[model samples]
Target: MDTTALLWLIGAAGSGKTATGWAVFRELAAAGVRAAFVDGDQVGMAYPAPPGDRDNEHVKARGLGALWAGYRAAGVQCVVAAGGVGTAATVADFAAQVPGAAMTVVELTVDAAERQARLIGRGSADLVEPAAALAAAFDRAPLTEHRVDTGGRTVDEVARLVLDRVGRPAAGAGPWPPRRFPAPEPIAGERVPLLWVCGATGVGKSTVAFPVFLALLAAGERAAYIDLAQVGWARPEAPGDPGGHLLRARNFGALWRSHRAAGSRVLVVSGSGGGPADMRRYLDAVPDCDPLVVRLDARPDVLAERVLMRSKGIGVELPGDELRGLAGADLDRAVAAAQAEAVRLAADGVGAVHLDTSDRSPEQLAAGIHARLVRRGGGAAAP
Candidate 1:
């Protein structure tokens, strides 16, 4: 008998694995394939406990075993299953129970601080201990898995990743003889779109990008911020280097993939200039999705002033000599380089939009972008 393909989503509590699993199920169903999902937690809840003993590992094991058996018997060709399968033993059990099944284990990671914040925000303080325990256990688990960070991603975005990895049809055919199935619904949450904001340093890109993010939030859209600059600067081995910036870009792309899989509609990624060659390298490793790439431009004097103001607000104390040495000397050169780079990026199918942010606040710049997005018939825009 042929066994079904099992896609197991493994992660700590609050890691968004369940949400990812649901998204994968929907995408498969939409492609006219038969798929089913079983929540491990729900199955665990139904398992029989020892007499007068609510907690028993043997009982839990039995529950998971039963769940696996049911899926096998039903001949489920595709299964999206999620829970805290954070051990080698559990993974082995799954493999043994489902013979001839292809298993894709998705391991979701989130920064500890962010995971704590999410649990608290959701009023599930009870999750903290279990989440922490799972994190510890995962470190020692001997499972080869595709890892996804869920710190700032939405459910839909993560789901797409899972689908790409595991939801492809077994026979590469349309869904089994169609009966009426409900139209796929987006998992409920705020949509955050990924927006890549690129330009040379001191071009007011972040100034423009942050406000766009805020505007999306104010417009009742959910959004998240990723400052690629800090991501680069934090690199200890390559501090103050351009390669650091490139690494940051690659990391951002990976993180961006997770967010896209979770279903974020708007994501503003800010950093210095990267051309089409850079973009091609990025798309080669990551999935392709069209994002609005806004290139902000400003005069030399305006850029210097903006940089100085930003530095001051952040408490970066610089002596007049050093300040002039760094900011003044680089202003004109940076501005000219950025303008040239923006044109190059435009040639790479980036759909770049140039915004002169010299005289505008971040909010104004973001509003301008919103207008452009609307005018472009909801597709990418070019300037």
Candidate 2:
């Protein structure tokens, strides 16, 4: 009998293992393959839920064993398993337990500080100490593994690496699909193209994205604005802490589902930040879509003015002189940082179009963008 194929992802916290596993599973599913995902955390919490503050090593182990057995019995041809199975001993145990299973162990590595930052941002205070411990554990573990550094990788990019290793074809290898955006009318199609807008905070990305949304709407095209930041903020179960911000951004898959279900022809996704990592997550969230990344640029003064204006329009109560202080100092630093990030993203093969928004209204910028899209045969002529 042919052995089941098992793709095991091992990594420290914040190493993108879970996200990679999920993405791989989705890709296989999309290809009409049967696959299952098994995460240690989810397995540990599967039955007879343990106390929130209690350690259940025995239960976790049993759950893991049962999960492996179930998958094997089910003849699951592909299994994407994610967790910190760091040691050679652990791999051996898995092999013994799941006889005839072809195991490919993937190790996701991230900088210690980055892992720590991600953990803290995810509201996992428990991970702070465990992350350090896990780092040490990984060094001591002797296991041949395929390594993926996720220090700055988005989940989808990391997922692509995994998919490649598992011998899956890369996305977009076949005929191009029709593009769609969220619209009032129903779309009768199997594939839809997606355009994503991403940039750093206060870069007027939304300002640019909204007009494109309106333009598409006016043209009777199906499109929608995917305000990821707003969705992140609106999550009710999110921890009321700073870490919730990153967690929400990473875990906000619902937004993509909503857009896809609405049959949006073009999705203008407003991301929280600009980076390879962010872009990866954005793409994974909205799968099988082409991304048109628009990076808006402006002079420091112009950026500062726009930030101040937005703050005022939102009815935020700042101290009497705080706006001026921020404009003079914080805003300058922010714009510089944003520019650097944009350049970094551009270098990552994001197909970015840079627009200098200085002295240009949103309407003018939209017109320019429309012209470029038309020239590229991606959009219709402006009405």
Candidate 3:
């Protein structure tokens, strides 16, 4: 008999539990382990009762219990499950169904603001209220043995965390020690990852990009954080608003070459525009580099608060040109600009991943961006 084990990844909607579960299932297979990946949502959908009742605590528990039993009896060594395991009763039901099997639960969490953005991005309507309800319920739910903050982590990274906690069932099957791919050729000429962080003023593009840059550097990858907005303002002789694209391109090229000489392997730039046109202009600057564009966004209220504090030097950080008009006037303009920019980015179809920075601090936001970059295979690519 195979020593079967079960792992339940529990979290609220948009907490990335499902994706992480699938990633774990795939990795376990890659490591020469046979694991069954079960999605509670799919299981519940096997039979419908009340509309939207699939996620009901009792309904999910019943469905998951049966699903686990089938997998266990089939001699599967591992079961990676996600969804609908948000409460103590549901978890207990799973335990009851699979007798003599050691079960581990890993709870994933993210801020409400990010979850809202994710749900909205995926076009999931009528979810805000229910999602909120579930979030509050989970807060009061029983504690799990392992807790992971999936706020800014890639699916692979989160899966790795779960695997580390619960050792693989088929251990020492192959490469007792995992093999690593060789490092890419040293960044030279123009082959490097050019990460562009864009959004309207007061959206924290520079703040987030700088930290991501530092993170890459700390990880031993040569990286540079460039604020194109700052660079544009520094040179007044150039034509066009905030310096023309031609001049900006010239400056960026020189900066890249200099950074390359200094052993930089990645370039992160934050600016105002994040649409297809904006990306094209960046590629014009570094014609040969792979581009990964990220758009940072926040609710109007969040944007207003950040702009107001920064404009007035309320915070310890030095003040800059963020102060456009009178106190309230500047904030209003920023809000409008951010809203309009978001609309434009969506319309332009640049395919940039929209990241919400409403409740996340600069560090958290940066870490999320870095995780996304790594997932996209952006940090370093072999030439």
Candidate 4:
């Protein structure tokens, strides 16, 4: 009898769901408890908004289901999922995706002052009021078997608090090593094609890149897509691991290899290369690969509007990068940075192909890039 379970952490934005959930799962994994961590935002990354799914919760949950199946098959005992899920229907939607696992809902709460402090710390002071509104909504209809107070507590402290109620699981073997996937045997003169979409923030890097990946699949290519930032997320970073680079690199290597082993011949990476060094790290991860870089850009106003839409959409869905921009001055700063990044990328000619996204829909942009990819010998080779 399988006794797999899930700790479903629900909270408003900035409630520490991700930080705490990461801490809890890392703690469990250290003991080789066969645990896996899933960030709702990370798994359900898509573009052009999936028609009627507002928060993208539906897709996020579905993605979780697929990942959970793989994890369970690989001998994982349980999963810790952290996201903003308020209504019973939403919870049910998530639980249905993880069949046979008992779901425990835990809400994380924070007071106004504490929330403000955290928001300000993150340069998202604009979120304080919006977060308060979200908190009020959660309060109006509380959803949780247990509530954990995150105010004035470190992420580990919150994790401990949750563990106090849920109790720790029995330990497994020593710390778990990275799971190996069955890779296809290499052939002489064979190289996988890697398409990396790079750009300024809000330039539609993810939005455009995802559709290209899908188009490749449509063309009968085994394709895999990853958001560079999403994969590298781990807490308690060492000074040398700024922005969790070291951790993300390690994780990215493992994921890329797994995708390769799974017989994917094309890789579409959606990321903004901070510089040559950052890009180099990811390039080194793939073996026998031809890399194609496409940079997406938009006018300043267009970029601002897009960033604001992602940052302030009460229930809007984005490609798993939760912190894009905030409201008010924070938004201004984000837009400025994105705009400046666009100019820099243009001057640097970082991408072999530059696509303007100001007036182009994601689908159109993807089509253009895919055509270019085919020309560059990065698309599915004739088969």
Candidate 5:
């Protein structure tokens, strides 16, 4: 392929774009094609929207542009982006990001009943009506290069259709490798410190992790940050990898390579769920790493208040992510589930250290974590 290709998959809530995108990416990898993928919402994750870019399409565009530069340098052939951008102008904006690349927009659609059923089944009853409105908006959207009705199709079927429309490589019959799925070889770089912050929901994992990332940078170490939940945005998850734990780990491997090449000496990552086994599997995905674990915990009362506030979209730090898995009526259920998770994680001893986040500011925790890493890694702060 002389030119780069980009496939942008768009859809309303529960339309299965993420699942299909994951399938497409996996199919390409199996066919021996170097490719990259991005969950669009995850890349443009600024809390306060950039001025004039209400939906943050511009931010997403910039992010795609930057990430593509890295992928292109590393020999990626194409990129698959999936999200909800409802206008032709927005498509054009994203296209402008990768100049000279051939961009194709694939819109996934479903019948109203199917849409409502899917969203409701996903525990997002509140989004049923809004999904209809967005589906209608997509109906009127311009530059819709291709459209596929994903109503009853399996994710792989939809992915095959999408790949067909976008011109993917045909798998040749020359494979003779062993059946076992081996762990990925470590990336070709010196080992770096990987700080994984984890805990129950509303325990401020991301809040603390981001600050630690900033602290590393402030202390003169090249640092990068990733939210495991964001990378695992795919649904109907991969076989035997419930919660997309390994899938996101696989994605993180790609990101780890990119960041490591750019001289990152430390990586700060946060995730809300995943037990001990899931955590160790991620270490496999990101090889050549000196791993440090920090589990943030909060008082039951404080945790409950934080969970309720987030569900209600009050005093939330991350916009557009408040009611992700919780519908209006699921607030109490979410609170209870979070409380239970807190206890379960404590019993499992998932982290090397558990920090009580009930009263400390994120910055304070970050400072302490940074100091500990520096001492443990024998000058982790130094470049």
Candidate 6:
């Protein structure tokens, strides 16, 4: 059988169906899997607004069938879609778009408070009307066999779950290649140490890195926050670029050396430090720096809650069921993954520290990391 699947995520606003589905698309893409994501809301814009009924014929002809057909022709194996699909008929409408396609319909749900909070954060004006309709419809509509609660989970975690159900990221497979960077200039300066802050998704890596960057400067040290996410991945690149990690490492090494030549004293970078190879890839970027790896730690529940709340603020409202998954099974998997990676990192015997931020604030986490870096000559003392 051809390895093809279709995932239709149905849910109301703040249910996290769309974002979670999108995450799945990205995950598959990163794995070099031919996948397509059809956003029902975006596609709906091509046609006029629907009438009073959401399940009417006019609304159902939103070109989803045509879209899926196009994707199938292009050799796309997996199709993921999400939007305001509330009825069984709507699910059938979507399925009809791609004949003989393996389809899975998932209903994502969330608590009222979380939905309201997300609606408010996303600037979803007229929340009361949508909230009431969602509540009534959920109660009246027939539940699907696959229902997910998205209350406190990270998008990555949820995406992983969906992919697992679809049997993706084949065993022993690595992620798609890391993004590429251009060669940086060679510069000379005194050797500076690197404070590497890294952990699983939603462990406050970015949140804590910024504060640590600032703290280093406040302590009268020359420091720069090198966010790996923003570095090589932001720009468009060619397909199947395998030299991304090497280029990114060279670029970081050049950037650090240049900064040091200009009197910069320390390097603070946040990114993949899960294992020896990940750490080596980054450390190789700045060859002269002694590396102080700090792995941020948190329980799965805590990590999921943090990631979901952050997503809401950023305008992605997740469902409570999805959050629950994050807090429960998803969270368990995430914690286990992080623990395994930490153990792998420990084999290096580089005095790496795993700091749990489950009960700590970002400020506290930053301060703790800052103290450690200062002691190691990674940066100046916090003022």
Among the numbered candidates, top TM-score falls to 5
Q: Residue by residue across 256-285, what tens digits does model 2's lDDT show?
A: 443444345555565554456645654655
Please report the candidate that would top lDDT against the real structure. Answer: 5
**lDDT to native, each model:** 0.56, 0.57, 0.63, 0.71, 0.72, 0.61
Between prediction 4 and prediction 6, which has the larger TM-score? 4
On TM-score, the stronger of 2 and 5 is 5
Question: Which of 2 and 6 is ahead in lDDT?
Answer: 6
lDDT of the structure predicted as candidate 2: 0.57
Candidate 4 lDDT over residue span 171-223, tens digit each: 64443334343332333347878889999877777778877888887777766
CA deviation > 4 Å runs, candidate 2:
1-191, 234-252, 314-351, 375-379
| TM-score of candidate 1 relative to the true fold | 0.41
| Segments in model 4 whose C-alpha atoms lie over 4 Å from true places | 1-37, 40-164, 167-189, 314-325, 380-383
Candidates 1 and 6, the one with greater TM-score: 6
Candidate structures ordered by lDDT, highest first: 5, 4, 3, 6, 2, 1
How well is each residue in 168-188 modelled by candidate 3, as lDDT tens digits? 676443221211212222433
| lDDT (Cα, tens digit) per residue for candidate 1, span 185-247 | 333354334466776555666667666666555555434455554322110122233443344
**How does each model score on TM-score?**
0.41, 0.41, 0.45, 0.57, 0.58, 0.44
Q: Give candidate 1's whole-model lDDT.
A: 0.56
Runs with alpha carbons beyond 4 Å of true place in candidate 6: 1-189, 234-244, 314-351
What's the candidate order when arranged by decreasing TM-score? Answer: 5, 4, 3, 6, 2, 1
Candidate 5 lDDT tens digits, 1-383: 33766788988887988778777877786676656677776665433344676776766666566556544543456677788886778878888778888778898999999889888876789989878988888787545768988988998999999888778844342332222234667677678788889999888888777776766766666666778776543321234556656556655665566555545667778886488887877888777888889899999999998887777655433422634456666877888888999999999988998899888888888778877888878125623
Clashes of 2: 12
Error of 4 at 101 (Å): 19
Q: TM-score of model 4 relative to the true fold?
A: 0.57
Candidate 6 residues 1-383, lDDT tens each? 43457777777787787789878777766666666666555333211223565433323333455345434434455677776676566666666656787877777777787877887777885764676587568768745766677777787887776666556733222233333444343335456777778776566776787788888777777665565543232112224544245434544454444345434567777765435665576676566677787777777667656656654454233222122235556656655565555455445543378888889898989988888877876766876
lDDT of 3 at 279: 56
